[model samples]
Target: MSNETPLPLVMLRAVVSGGCDVTPPQRPLTPSGRN
Candidate 1:
């Protein structure tokens, strides 16, 4: 939650505009698995 403090609104706007079909990873869970 700490990381989301700044861009929280951006995220909310994205989901609100993009709809529930979109999916985003939490953290340390890179899609490339490099972390």
Candidate 2:
């Protein structure tokens, strides 16, 4: 593998580690910010 982290993977990791304990359902990034 190239060793470079994928964008989605990085985002998912951020979301998962960021606030899954506080708010699991609304964890994913908003479309306005994602784009």
Candidate 3:
């Protein structure tokens, strides 16, 4: 598998890890129904 990962995956990880405090409105990148 490639060492490079998708940008969304990285962002998700960051959010899950508490590294990113993204608000629902600010995070339009993900349409996972958070809005």
Write the residue-wise lDDT of candidate 1 on 1-35 in tens digits: 75667587888978776763343333444464545
Off by over 4 Å in 1: 1-5, 20-35
In candidate 2, residue 11 scores what lDDT? 90
Question: Candidate 3, residues 1-35: lDDT per residue as tens digits?
Answer: 35888889888888876744556457688777766
Clashing pairs for predicted structure model 2, backbone only: none
> lDDT of all predictions, in order shown?
0.59, 0.67, 0.71
How many residue pairs clash in model 2? 0
Clashes of each: 0, 0, 0
TM-score winner = 2
TM-score of 1: 0.38
**Candidate 3 error regions (>4 Å):** 19-35
lDDT of 2 by residue, 1-35 (tens): 45898989889989878766546345555443534
Q: Among all windows of ten consecutive residues in candidate 1, which has the lowest summed lDDT?
A: 20-29
TM-scores, one per candidate: 0.38, 0.46, 0.42
- Ranked candidates, highest TM-score first: 2, 3, 1
| Rank ordering of all candidates by lDDT, starting from the highest | 3, 2, 1
